[model samples]
Target chain A: MRRILSSVTDGRGFDILLVSITMIFLLALSGMPLVYNVVMSFQEVDMFNLNTFSRPYAGLENYREVVSQPEFGLILKNTAFFVFGSIAGQFVLGFALAMFFMMRFPFAATIRGVFLVSWVMPGLVVGALWGWILAGDFGVLNAILKGIGVIDSTMFWKSDPRLSIWAVTIANIWLGLAFNMMLLSVGLAAIPRDLYEAAELDGANGWHRFTTMTLPMMRSTIGAVLALGLIYTLQQFDLFPAITEGGPANSSNVAQYWAWQYSFLLFDFAKGATVSVMMLGFVLIASIVYVWSTRHEVRG
Target chain B: MTPQIEIASVDKHYGAYHALKDINLTIPRGAFTALVGPSGCGKSTLLRSIAGLESITSGNLRIAGTEMSGVPPRKRDVAMVFQSYALYPHMNVLGNLTYSLRFKGFNKEQARKKADEVAQVIGLTELLERYPRELSGGQRQRVAMGRAIICEPKAFLFDEPLSNLDAALRVHMRMEIRALHDRLGATSVYVTHDQVEAMTMADHVVVMRAGVIEQQGAPLELYDNPANKFVAGFIGSPAMNFLDATVAEDGRSARLEIAGKPVLPLARTLQPGREVTVGLRPEHLRIDTAAPRLQVPVRVVESTGSLTYSTTETEPELMIVEQGRGRYRAGETLPLTIAPEDIHLFDPTSGTAL
Candidate 1:
C-alpha cells in the first residue's frame, strides 16, 4: 500500500494516472458517443425506442437509405466544395499574409496580432458579420466590386442555388485564416536567419531561396495546418444556420449540417448517425496525416 | 597587383549608433586576412558589410574590379562559412554541396560530379547520402566549408567557423582550413575573437576595437612592434604587464615604482622626468638572483609541467611566466630582470606606444 501510494504521488504511476484520466474523459464523452452513433446507425431506431439500448439489427438499411436519398449527391458535392475551397483559400491567403508580416516594418507585429480577432471570435459572430458584408444589395463587398467595374449586378450569395454553398465557404475561409497564419508564422520563425544568409551567399536569389529553404522547412507545419483545416471545415456548423442554413433547395447543405437536420428537424435518427460516421472516417485520415508529418519535426 | 577587395571610407550606422567608422582595407588576390576583436567591436558588422549582407551607410566597396555598391550577395560571387554551419536540415550532404551549382544551371551529372570532388576534399565522401542532422559537429563544419569552396568563388569569408568544435577538433581543423586555403590559393577573410586563431590561421591580421582598426599587419609584426599599448596588451597570450614609471634625471633609464624603486635601463632616451607607463611581457621577465633588477615577494605560483606562471605580492602585482617547472612558493621573495630591449614604454595619458 505504501509503495503504491508513493508511486502514485511521485513516480511512473503518476504519469499513468494522468493519461488514464484523459482516456476516461474521452471515453465517456467522445468515444462512447461515437460507438453509440455507429451502433445506432446499424439498428432500426425510432422516436419510441430511442431511450432503450436494445434495438432490432437492420444491416446496411440505414446506410442504403441515407445514400439513396435524393439530396445525398448534392449535399456530398457541396461538402467537397466547401472543404476544398475553404482549405485552399485559407492556406494560400494565410501563407501569403504570414510571409508579408515577416518583413521588417513598424507595427508589423501589431497588425499581425490584430488579424487573430477572427480566430478568437465565436463562429456565429463571424458568420453574421460575413453575412452582412456579403449581402446582395447594400453589402460592402458588392459596392466595392461594382465600383471597381468587376460586377454589373450585385451578387446574391445566399439565395442563388449555385452560390449558396460558396457563401458559407467564403465565411469559413475568413474564420480559419488567422489560425493558419499563426501556425505558419511560428514555423517561419523557427527557421534560423543564418540559413537564409547562407543561401544568399550560395548564389540563391529570393525566389530560389523560398523554394529551396522556406518551402522545404515548412513541410511539417504546412501538413499540420492543412489537416487541421480539413477537420475544422468539416466540423463547421454555426455558419450554416447563420448564413444560408444549407438552403435554397439543399444546394449549400453539407454533410454535417445535413446530419443535424436529419436528427433534429426531420427526426430521422439512423440517417443522422449514418452521415456522421462517414465524416468520422475523413477526420481519422486527417488525424493520421497530422501525426505523421509532426513525427519528423526535429531539424538539424 | 591590385587588391581583390578594396573598401574605401566605409561607414555603417544602425539608426543613430555608428557601427563601422570610416574603414579602409585592402585584401590581396590570395591573402588570408582575419578580422579579430572582442565582442561588440564591429568585427562581424564589417565582415557582413563586405559580404553585402549588411549595407554600409556610406562607402565604396569594390570586389575584384567592379563597384559592389547596391549589389546583392548572390552577384558578388563570394562564399561565406557561417559559425552555425547553417546546413539545410532537409537536404542531404550531396544536395547541400551542389545547391549553388543547380541554381547556376548545372545538370544533375555535372553537379553531382562537382559535389563528389568537393566531398572528397573535405573527407565527407561516405556521408553524401546522410542529412546534416546525422553528422557530428566537426563533420557539419567541414560540410559548410565544402559548400563554400565548391563554386570556386572569388573570395571565402569565415565567421568564426571553428568555434563550435571541441578544443582538439578546433586545433586540427585550424590547420586543415589553412591547408585548404593554401591549396586553393583563394582570397579569404576570417573573423574571430580569439587572438590565437588569428595569429595561427591568417597571413595578415587586422585587430579591431570599437569599430576602428587598431593595427593590421603580419602576425609577428603586430607582436614584435605593436603600434599602440592596446595592441601590445591584446596580442600576447597572458597579456603584457603595465607599471607606473618616471624617466630619471639621467635620461637613459626609468624608475619603476614597485615594492622596491628599481631603475630599469631603457632602449631609447626619453624626455627627462617624464611620467610614463612601462610594458613588460610576462615571458620576458625572469627570476635572476645573480643580477637582480626588481625585488618582489611571490604571492602565488602555478606550474603546468612545462612552464611556471607566478604573481608577485606587491602593491601593483607583476605576473611572471618562465620556462620549466618552478619550485617557488607563496611569500618567497625573488629578483626579476628583463632585457632592456624587451621593455616597452607607452604614454600614460593616451596609452600609445612611445
Candidate 2:
C-alpha cells in the first residue's frame, strides 16, 4: 500500500497513474457508451428491454429497417450536402479573413479576436439569431437582397423544401467560420517571415509566392481544418431545429436530426443507434485525418 | 567601371524611429562590398533595401544604371541569401533550386537541367532529392547560395548568410563564397556584424554606426587610417584601446592620463593643450624594456599558441597583443611602447579623427 501511495506521488509511477485515470474516465464516459450503442443497434431494443443490458439479439435487422425507410435516402443526401457545403463555405471565407487580418494594421489582432464571438456563443443561440435573419418575408437577408436589387420576391428560406436545407447550412457555415479562421491563423503565424522575403528575392510574384510558399507551408493546417470541419458539420444539430427543424416535408432532415427523431419522437432506439453507429464510421475517418495531419506539421 | 548598384540620399523611417538616414553608396560592377556594423546599425536594412525587399522612403536607387524606385522585388532581378537560409521546407533540394526557374517560364526539363548544373556547382549533387530539413547547416547554406546563383541575377545580396554555421564551417563557407563570387564575377553585397568576415571577404567594407556610414574604403585603408574612433574600435578584434590624453604646449607630444602620466611623442602636430582621445590597436602596442615607455602592472595574461594578449592594471585597462607566447605574469609591471605613427588621434568630444 505504501509503495502504491508513494508511486502515485512521485516518479514514472505518477505519470502512469495520471494517464490511467484519464484512460479509465474516457472508457467509462465515451468508450462504454459507444460499445453500448453499437450493441443496442444489434439487439431488439424496445421500451421494456431498454432498462436492461441483456436483450435478445437481432443482428442486421435494425440496419435493414433503417435503410428501407422512405426518408433514408433523402436524409443521407441532405447530410452529405450539409457537410460538404458548410465545410467549403466555412474554410474559404475563414482563410480569406485570416489572411486579411494577418496584415500589420492597427487593431488587426483585436478585430480578429472579436471574431471569436461567433465561435464562443452557444450554437443554439447563434441558430436562434440566424433563425430571424433567415425568415422568408421579414428576415434581414431578404430585406438586404431586396435592397440590393438581387431579388424582387421573398425567397422562403425555412418553409420551402429547396431553401430550408440551405438556410441551415448557411447558419452552420457562419457558426464554424470563426473556428477555422483561428486555427488557420495559428498556422499562418507559424511560418517564418524570412521565407516570404527570400521568395520575393527569388523573383516570385505575388500569386506565385502564394502558390509556392504560403500554400505549401499551410498543407498540414489546411488538412486539419478541413477534417475538423467535416466532423463538426456532421455533429451539427442545433442549427437545424432553430432554422428549419428538418421539416417542410423533411427536405432538410439530416442524419443527426433524423437519429434524434427516431429515438425520442418515434421511440425507435434500435434505428437511432444504427444511424448513429454509421455516423461513427465517418467521424472515425475524420478523426484519423485530423490526427495524421496535425502530426505531420512541417516546421523548421 | 560603371556602378552595378547606386543609392543616393536614402532614408528609412519606421513610424517615428529613423532606421537609415541620408545614406549614399555605390557598388562598382563585379566588386564585393560588405556592409558591416554592430547589431541595429542598419546593415541588414541596407541589404534588404538593395534587394528590393524593402522600399526606401525617399531616395533614388539605380541598379545597372536603371532607376529602381517603386519597382517590386520580382521585377528587380536581384537574388538574396537570407540568414535563415529560407530553403522552402516542403520542397526538396532540386525543387528549391528550380523554384525561380518556374517563374521564368522554364519547362520541367530545362528547369531540372539547370538545377542539376547548379547542384553540381554547389556540391549538392547527391542530395538533390533530400528536403531542406534533411540537410546540415553548411549544406543548407550552400543550397541557399546555389538558389541565388542559379538565376544569374544582376546582383547578389547576402544578409549574414554564414552567421548560423559552426565556427569551422563559417570559415570554410567564407572562402567558398568568395571563390564563387570570383568565378561568377558577380556584383555582391554582403552584410555581417563580424568585422573579420567583412575584412577578409569584401574588397570594399562600409562601416555603419547609428544609421550613418562611419567609414567605407578598402579593407586595409580602413584599418590603417580609420576615419573615426568608432571605426577603429569596431574594425579590430579584442578592440582598440582608447586612452584620455592632452596635447602638450609644443603640439608634438601628448601626456597620457595613466598612473605615471607618461608623455608620448605625436606623429602629427595638433592644437596645443587640446583634449584628445588616443586610439591604439592592440597589435600595434609592443613590449620594449629599453625604450622610453609607460610602465604599468599587468592584470591578466592570456595566450593562444601563436599569439599572446595581456592587459595592464590602469584605471581604464589597456590591452596589448604580441606575437608568440607571453612571458609576463599577473602583478608584474611591464613597459609598453607603440610607434608614434601607429597612434591615432581623435577629438575627445566628437570622436572624429584629427
Candidate 3:
C-alpha cells in the first residue's frame, strides 16, 4: 500500500494516474456516445424501443434510407457551398487584416485587439446580430449596397431560397474572421523582420518579397488555419437556428442541421446518427490535416 | 575613376534623436572601407543609409556616380550580409542563393547554374539541399555571403557578419571575407565595433562617435597619425595611455604628472608652459632603466602566453602591453620610456591633436 501510495505521489504511476483521469472523461462522454451512435445507426431505432440498446439488426438499411431522402441532394450541395464559401471568405479577409495590422502605425495593436470582440461573442448572438444587418428592408448592408448603387432592390437574405444558405455563410464568415486573423497574425509575427530587409537589399521589390518570402514562410500556418477552419465550419449549428432555422423549404439545410432535424424534429434517431457519421469522416480528415501541418510548428 | 559611393553632408534623425550628423564619405572603386565605432554610434545607421535601407534626413547620396536620393534599397542594387545571416528558414541553400536571380528575371535553369557556380565558390556545393536550420553557424554565414555575391551588385555591405560565430571561427571567417573581397575586387563597406577588426580588414577605415565622423583614412595613416584624441584612443588596442602634462619653459620638453614631475622630451616645438594631454601607445613604452623617464608602481599584470599586459599605479592608471613575458612584479616601481615622435600631444581643453 505504501509503495503504491508513494508511486502515485511522484513516479511513473503519477503520469499514469493523470492520463487515466482524462481517458475516463473522454471515454465516458465522447467515446461512449460515438460508439453508441455508430451502433445505433446499424440498428432499427424506432420510437418503440428508443430507450434500449439492443434492437433488431438493420444493417445498411438506415444508411440507404438516409441517402434516399428527397432533400439529400440539395442538402449536400448547400453544405458544400457553405463550407467552401465560408472558408474562402474568412481566410482571405482574415489574412488581409492580419497583414494590415503588421504595418508600423499608431494604435495597430489596440485596433487588432478590438477585432477579438467578434471571436468572443457567442455564435447565436453573432447570428442574431448578422440577421438584423442582413434583413430584407431595414438592413444596414442592403441600405449601403443600395446607397452605393450596387443594387436598386433590397436583397432578401434570410427569406429567399437562393440567398438562405448564403445568409448563414456570411454570418459564419464574420464569426470566424477574427479567429483566423489572430492565428495568422501570430504566424506573421513569428517571421524575422531582418528577412524582409535582407530580401529588399537582394533586389526584391514588395510583390516579389511577398511571393518569395512571406507566402512560403506562412505555408504551415495557413495549412493549420484552413484545416481548423474547415472543422469549425462543418460543426457550425447555432447560426442556422438563430437566422434562417434552415428554412425557405430546406434551402439552407446543411448536413449538421439536417442531422438535428432528423433525430429531434422527426424523431428518426437512426437517420440522425447515420447522417452525423458521414460528417465524422470529413472531420476526421480535417483533424489529420491539422496534426500534419503542425508538425513543423516547433521549428527554431 | 569616380567613387563607387559618395555621401555628401548626410544627416539622419529619428523624431528628436539626431542619428547621423552631417556625414560625408567617399568610397573609391574596389576599396574595402570599414565603419567602426561603439554601439549606437551611427556606424550601422550610416551603412544602412548607404544601402538605402534608412533614408537620410537631408543630403545627397550617390552610388557609382548616380544620384541615389530617395532611391529604394532594391533600386540601389547593393546587397548586404546581415549579422544574423537571415537565411530563409523554409528554403534550401540553393533556393536562398537563387531567389534574387529569379526576381531579376533569370530563368530557372540559368539561375540554378549560377547558384551552382556561386555555391562552388562559397564551398556550399555539398550543402546545396540543406535547409538553414540544418546547417551549422559557419555554413549559414557562408551561404549569406554566397547570396550577397551571386547578385554581383554595385557594392557589398556587411553589418558585423561574423559576430555570431565562436572566436576561432570569427577570426577564420574574417580572413575569408577579406580574401573574397580582394578576389572579386568588390567595393565593400563593413561595419563593426571592434577596432582590431576594422584595422586588420579595412584599407580605408572610418571611425565614428555619436553620429559624427571622427576620422577616416588608411588603416596605417589613422594608426601612425591619428587626427584627434578620440581617434588616437580608439584606433589602438589596450588603448592609448593618456596622462596630464604641461610643456616646460624650454618648449621642447614637457613634464609628465607621474611621480616627481618627470620631464618627457617632445618631438616638436610647442608653446612654452602650455597645458596639454599626452598620448602614449602601450607598445612604445619600454623598460629603459639606463635612462629612466617616468616611474610608477605596477598595479596588475596579465599574461596571454605571448604578450604581457600590465597596469601602473597612478592617479589615472596607465596600461602597458609588452611584447614578451614581463619580469616586473606588482607593487614594484618600474621605469618606462617612449620615443619622442610617439609622444602624442593634444590640447587639454579640446582633446584635439596639437
Q: In model 3, how large is the Cα lDDT of residue B135? A: 95
Off by over 4 Å in 2: A1-6
DockQ for every model comes to 0.85, 0.82, 0.70
Candidate 2 TM-score restricted to chain A:
0.97
Instruction: Score residue B335 of candidate 1 by CA lDDT.
Output: 82
Cα error, candidate 2, residue A125 (Å): 0.7
Model 3, residue A115: distance off in Å is 0.7
Residue A199 displacement in candidate 1 (angstroms): 0.9
Per-residue lDDT for B130 in model 1?
96
lDDT of 1 by residue, B1-354 (tens): 569999899999999998998899999999999999899899999999989999999989999989998999999999999999999999999999999898788999999999999998989999999999999999999999999999999899999998999999999999999999999999999999999999999999999999999999999999988888899999988899999999999888999888668999998898899999999999999889899888889999999989899998876888899999886788888788999999999999999898
The best candidate in terms of DockQ: 1
> Candidate 1 chain B: minimum summed lDDT over ten consecutive residues — where?
B327-336
lDDT of 1 by residue, A38-85 (tens): 999998989999999899999999999999999999999999999999
Kindly state the fnat score of candidate 2: 0.84
| Model 3 CA deviation exceeding 4 Å by range | A1-11, B258-260
lDDT (Cα, tens digit) per residue for candidate 2, span A143-187: 999999999999998999999999999999999999999999998
* Model 3 docking grade: medium
C-alpha positional error of residue A69 in candidate 3 after TM-score superposition, expressed in Å: 0.9
